[model samples]
Target: MPEVTPQQHALFEEQGHVVIGPILPPADVARLRQAFEAQAAAWAAEIDTPLDDYLAVVSQWTNVWEHNPVFREQLYHQRAAAIAAELIGCQRVRVFHDHLIVKPPHGGSTVPWHRDLPNWPVAEPRAVSCWLALDDVTAESGAMRFMPGGHREPVTRSIDFLNEAKVWGERERDAVPVAVPAGSAVFHHCLSWHTSPPNSTAGWRRAYITIYLDATCTYDPTRAAWHPMAGRVSVPAGATFNEDVFPTLGPGLSAAHLATLRGGAA
Candidate 1:
């Protein structure tokens, strides 16, 4: 599994986000992309909205790991989890959730500018998310833009993506648009300010995001009624997230399996 260098850790703290590889090899990337497309098509077929209305918002299928083996493999990949632990500065990382976000060509809706932690059920800010692109992403293709060092500020209220400017009324022109090729991933702090614009390109913008939380994250009852994770665990408020749902990876990996993952060279 890959580990973060001191320099990368510094970058994350300074900017609130960092760009990582074509983290998966070409074959793995291709397989994951296919899985996401399959899931997206299945979801789009079930939507009854007009194309115009649908394009006004991005599509999100959460906890996709429960449904697809390919997604599950990618979501719990050793390298990816290791990266999350490094960026989050946590001893152990737990699965918060995973989602596939699709932006249809030419008219996908804009994702409103907002901070993630405010909308989640977790009480702490030690969560990180990896947004893996499945298509060639451009600024006009609804690529995510971030406000560098924005996570240092207090959490702000969630925004209505389709109607808002930047979080707290900042200019849209100020956010930094992060464009990367397919297979590249961006890691962002839960409090980082981010949003994506409408897709003006000719192809769909596909993304698979896996979020990891501090292993010791506890449920916040205040947001439980609406937060998705509320129903996924059996623990009470202030209790650690259960192991069955959010497995720890670094110390959890079996010795034999860990060796294989490291190409028998660990």
Candidate 2:
């Protein structure tokens, strides 16, 4: 597991995002890619779209861990979660959800600039997403560009991907594209303004993103009533997330605490 050094933590606090160098080795990366390919094939088979067209379509699947064993393990990746916890400055963290975004070579569309917290159902903005790249990412290959310190701004409505309108006025000039090799990851704040351009390269751009919320984070449907994952919530508004769905993780968390997290008797 790679540690988020103090300097790196400072950078994250300052810029609202920071690149964590390679956490997975070549073997792990290979296994993840294989799992994704298999799962993608299954999804393509179930859809009416032709396989060729389906592969070309930019794919965004939420909670793949619910069906894919490899992705299930990835959801609990200690290294990634630890880094997320460190970035959020929380003692413990829980899974909000995981999503897989794949931009196929040549045909993917651009994602408009937006802040994540405004689109989530959480009551607080204490969350971070660990975006692990499954392929070499470059500016020309749908790499994420961020508006540094944009998280400090007030939250706003989600952006329409079909529109090319710029939301962050003068701050757009300060946006920076972050490129990383396969097995590396970049963690960004939930409120950070970010976007990615369409892939123009011959290679695919795949990213598995796991969003971790601070343990104290509570559910709030009003934040995003139509959020895709909102239906999975079993807790009342303003209550802590259910551990069965959002497994809590932390350093030196006791067995009794784990039981409590699961809403069970310790």
Candidate 3:
């Protein structure tokens, strides 16, 4: 497993994102890719014909934990979970959700720029997301692009799913395109402004993302839950945190890791 460095922590604090390389070995990456492909194929068969066809051919989908234990296990994978723990400054982090964004060759549309927090049912601002590359991601292959330090800005008015340009302003100068090799990972704040271009390549561009909420983060049950699996673990509105919802990932807890879980640190 790749150890989180102080430099990485500092970069995350300053820029609201960081990239860690070689988090998964080649064999593990292969396993995850196979699992994702299998799940995607199964999902395609369940939804209505054309819609399922579209999803199978040209869109993104998530929340496979309900159907596959392998998908759930991938979310809590020891190395990836450890990285998430470090990113959120928590010893324990809940598997908020898992997402699959597959861009078919020459077909997938661009994902709009948006902050994940606004879309989430939780009120906590410290949640983190790890986007693992399942294939070589490049600018033409629909790699994620993030606006550096955009998370610190005020939350803009939320827009409907159809209006992509209206939802996010033009890309800023500090916006960086993350082109990661398969098996690497990019860690970003939940509030970070990010988007991806359409896939213009010849093969599918696939990625698996697992979102994690710090144990100290509070939940708002009133907000519309994005997934049925989301409500599976719920903490009261004003509660400091819930361990049953956000379990620890490492060998043991410590000041750095436990602080966030107890609502004592960032």
Candidate 4:
């Protein structure tokens, strides 16, 4: 399948998002789900909690590429990489991070609507995330909801979840639910305001999210962006992604790597 089409690019630019179905074949999806379950089980065991009773898990494996070969493989997958390249108009992109969000049955929690860039240390405004569904996601099962053109809005005051009323503002008119099937993926701009409601269904809602930023994207360390509760981490204050945080993984793409590859820089 073509990694990206002109129509897809246009849609992303206009709507600030795009959804692609079956981006991961059946086998690929199965493998990823297996990996996620294993990781989740191990994590739950360490925390002295029952795996089946967890509410919402986020950012379990920070540097996933270092621990899981499957994650490493996915980071360099041609389809994902190509799509990211096209979306960011970069010659090469690097894996910013990977997160596995699992909402267990009867998990009642709302991920407040907010933009990721405000939470990240990256200055690049072009980063994108691919939310790959490992299971069928529905409105009742905590499927992601996004506001159209939300990315265009200026960054608002950061929300403190402790104060629910203070954090969640009035819902925008363009906000809509995004229901995706297994093996499908939703592409969203980093600045898009989005969130998911609680999963009242009996089954788990599983999603594998990977964020990609162009190698040339700049970093902004003022936000002190780091993993949740992990404390501050090292990142260049004003350099592009490649100069500091993002590491190159693919082979034989060095020339294309320096210049944004998607725009034919190589």
Q: How do the predictions measure up, each by TM-score?
A: 0.84, 0.90, 0.83, 0.83
For 146-167, candidate 3 gives per-residue lDDT tens digits of 8888878876644456855533
Q: Which candidate, 2 or 3, would have the higher lDDT against the true structure?
A: 2
Say which candidate scores most in TM-score: 2
Candidate 3 stretches with Cα past 4 Å from truth are 48-58, 164-171, 222-235, 240-252, 256-266
| Candidate 4 stretches greater than 4 Å from native | 53-61, 164-171, 225-235, 241-245, 249-266
RMSD of 4: 4.0
Q: Per-residue lDDT tens digits of candidate 1, residues 1-266?
A: 43655566677888898888878777877898788767655655668655446545647878899888999888778888878876765567898888888877786676777888877778788899999888878888988999888889887766655676663455555678999788888889999988888889889888889989978888776763577777787888888787887766656444454344334222
Cα lDDT tens digits for candidate 4, 1-266? 33677677777777778888788888988898788778767767878888765435442356565567786677667677667767777666767777777777777578887777777776667788988888899999999888888788887655666674323347565578899899988989888878888888998788878888876666676663554512433545676554233564343234444243344322
Error of 2 at 194 (Å): 0.1
lDDT of each: 0.78, 0.84, 0.73, 0.71
Q: Cα miss at 259, model 4 (Å)? A: 12
Instruction: Report model 2's TM-score to 2 decimal places.
Output: 0.90
Give the clashing pairs for model 4.
90-261, 90-262, 91-260, 91-261, 91-262
How large an RMSD does model 2 have? 5.5
Which candidate gets the maximum lDDT versus the true structure?
A: 2
Could you give candidate 2's per-residue lDDT for residues 107-132 as a string of tens digits? 68888888899888998999999999
**Rank order by lDDT, top first?**
2, 1, 3, 4
Winner by TM-score between candidate 4 and candidate 2: 2
Assess the local accuracy of residue 7 in candidate 1 as a C-alpha lDDT between 0 and 100: 62
